[model samples]
Target: MSEPEELPQREQRESTKKKKKTKRSGKKKKEQREGEEQVEFEQEVQSVSECVVLHGIFKLGKKSHDVLLTRTKLTWTPIIPENPTGETGVPQSGEVLLQDIFAVKVKRRRAAGQESGGPVLGVALFWCRRKGRRLEEDTLHLHNASSEHTHTWYNTLKELLTGFSNRPTNLKVFINPSSHKKEAVHIYRDHVAPLFKMADIRTDITVTERKGHVLSVIKECKLDEYDGVVCVGGDGSVAELCHALVLRAQLDADSPEKPVRATLPLGIIPAGSTDVVSCSVHGVRDPVTAALHIVLGHLQQVDMCSFSSHGQLVCFGFSAMFGFGGRSLARAEKKRWMPSSRRREYALVKTLARLRPEDCQLSFLSARKSNSNLFVQRDKDQDQDQDPKSEGEESWVTNQGLYLSISIMSIPCLSPHAPQGLAPNTSLANGSAALIAVGNTSRSEFIKHLKRYSSSTGQFNFSFVETHAVSAVKIRPCSLIGCSEDESEEEGDLKTTPFIHAEGTTFPWNIDGELVEIANEVLIRVHPRLITLYGEEVEEAESSVSCSCI
Candidate 1:
């Protein structure tokens, strides 16, 4: 049965070859027709010439292929050993997209028992490709015919990658191994570093030894050497890096002491407990997503809130809070011994157990007289000079109330806990913050407001909660001697605000995620577009009027 089938198969092959010879003329006419019908871009590309040709092994495979470099891509065709003197067996095994190639470099392997390397020429390429909806990366290692061939290939590819501004060629990376979940280093190794390699970015990485270590290093860094700085940690780490850049710029400016905006854009890879900054910027806490944004050179401007107390600069923060938000963070700090997964829940439970309203004085100046007249008066104000007026001419609204929470956010403040953001309508670089003030309310209602953050339709659904867009705010604690030390903490009993027995009482200020030391009166001002970050543009919808308690 095998012999009979084999004989017919040979006859079929012969008949197919004869048919190919007869149809050769028709095939050429068909090819011409197809070419004429092709897109204009394809017809234009046909005139481009092949740039380079080299023999190399690709992607760690043993067999070598004849690689052809064209203007737009590198195509590899397998060498048919059996038909060496005949036509190539395979048309084209694969092709590498030149635009996707992030890095190209020459490499060498050392000889056995010798200090010197061999005469073999090798090249490595890192490139990205889309797999379904996600971007994937791979490195192709190839052996060129000679050292000159390897150099020529590397130089040509390098030139192309350099021309693409989307890829960052050099970076200073700060990895905090002790951030929230303490997984920054691992995340960088697993997800971020490979992408950088693919993009051919040179990185100087520093695993911070202690808190504020990155700040000190950035202060003394040669700013001209690196393209940007990357923070591989939580919001606190990103904030610290931003602060360093701001301070460095201020020191270099003509007015050394004045607050200066950060010129060097920041790239954040989320690896902490609650990566509010990263989540808000990238819409996710995934490290690879942030890394891709950096490689692609995506830029977004964000405001920074400068805190001043007693006419002295306290610190800079993307977000600030002094009420329940601050209290929950302060409470979370004491439970450091608890497992990370359980720590936040335990702290929230503990803080809620002792929840109460605090009496405070809040004063703020609106950037706009009213939201209704925002765009209507913009051109008129810019066209005419303002009339000179005394400082008293500026209107500031003041309110005294028993408040559950007061949070001022410069960014959207998006996180897993609050996808709509702590302040849902907050703009990223609008030169204002979303100031949310919650009046004294029952515990159940306050909990409901908190729950609304996790939902899209009703974040500010309570009458007790109010949100306003403001440029500046002054907060002063009204009741200083609210609770004593023992009275503040009892099993299942909680205190409203942090108490101090000193001359003036101080309450914890939650700046970003890290808790600040106690302070009495704090003034916060939002600087417009103060810092640039490698982030995608955020489409924010003002949802302040979207929903109300029913």
Candidate 2:
């Protein structure tokens, strides 16, 4: 009995020893990691007396423009010369308003005397009416007060302090990079970080512990404390931020107020393979070039699409990318999906294109879209508020269809590698999208047809492809038939099953440039001037066939 009692004590001691040993080992590993990290603290600029107000204008939906006012609050006394006649600068559409208010810390001593710690900052509201290319002198008036023009003394002070900023101060940056490209992190530190410092931009970097690490911080972190947010990857990184924004916008209810998002202008420092948003905004693919955008602070409002589900229909922001042949073959390989130590490689020729099936028909919205299998870029979308196509001249078929890509870009330049850009007639604020359709029978025909669309004369200029910046599309499965009528046969993919009945009303929808699954089909609409980004006027894309084929 005594021995048994001792045995129990020994076992308990052993268990405690094991736990202690494990804890020590874990702590050692963590310490090793900390010691091995070569990251050094870099000092950032902290304050600025003067600030420049950068006004960026980009259209979102058709006619709406997002106005960005960036500056640090300083005593702004626009030197107005003695001229009742005029002061010239502000655009024809804009009027300047100034308010005079005093912020005096005052206390009354039982109505006996005035008590004060300092002077009360008194603010007076002044409106400078615009007539032609000049502004009439600012007057103390509240007439025609709109939201943009009205502000309490407190808010005006906040705006003055936050909007315009000093070089390199009070900037909190979140850059948790997840890159397939191995060199992305090094590039950020070596090349990108230096440029940020040169701009006098102060930043605190947080390397991610895991996926969505940065996202968690963005969602809950006090955005008011930060002046701006910058991302450091490709479209995936931008997609992450967009997801955060979309999530926050819906955090309260189905549709929450967009929040004080201007304080959190999404900044991208591209360190990803496909830096779609970065390239599109600045028209430059290099990280250094991307850094320059931060200084410019040109707010451009690009279009974003929202997707949900419909009954037996698929929808998305841009397009549903269905790969055909080469593109399909490249993506179909499992190895390509895995992270590679080196650059992800693919066959120069169209190995993936071999999967293309000739016997296929495009069935959507009751239109029997069939022809020689080719690469087609949808150029325009007709008014959907039309009579449904009569079933008279229709033959329904589906399956063995190689690829279908759906997209609605506010601007034309999709990515740096995009062979074709948004249509010329299309506007960044157009509140629409462009569709690309590739229909080809053979690999040879597919390449030949696509070449025309990618050349100096892009898709809209080419005949095979149609480039339309439209609303959205719905995808459905139909009976597959042969080239001739009455030759319809049920293919495995086209077969009907209750569970997999090709009736998934909800699936993943691609927004911006990433894939996300929503509860319902998507109806991508351009939010009229929803956001503003730092940008310059984009030169029309010049498609050059002079380079090798895409």
lDDT of 1 by residue, 309-385 (tens): 88888778899887787887888899898876577777676666677676789988776433421222222122111
- What is the Cα-based TM-score of model 1? 0.71
Clash number by candidate, in order: 1, 81
| lDDT value, residue 480 of candidate 1 | 54
Regions more than 4 Å wrong, model 2: 1-169, 252-263, 310-320, 323-333, 337-352, 355-407, 419-425, 439-442, 452-454, 461-464, 477-523, 540-550
Model 2 Cα lDDT, one tens digit per residue, 434-454:
445453344444455545544
lDDT of 2 at 203: 81
lDDT of each: 0.74, 0.43
Model 1: number of clashes?
1
For all predictions, the C-alpha RMSD in Å is: 17.3, 26.1
lDDT, residue 162, candidate 1: 69
TM-scores, all models, native as reference? 0.71, 0.51
The pairs that clash in candidate 1 are: 354-494
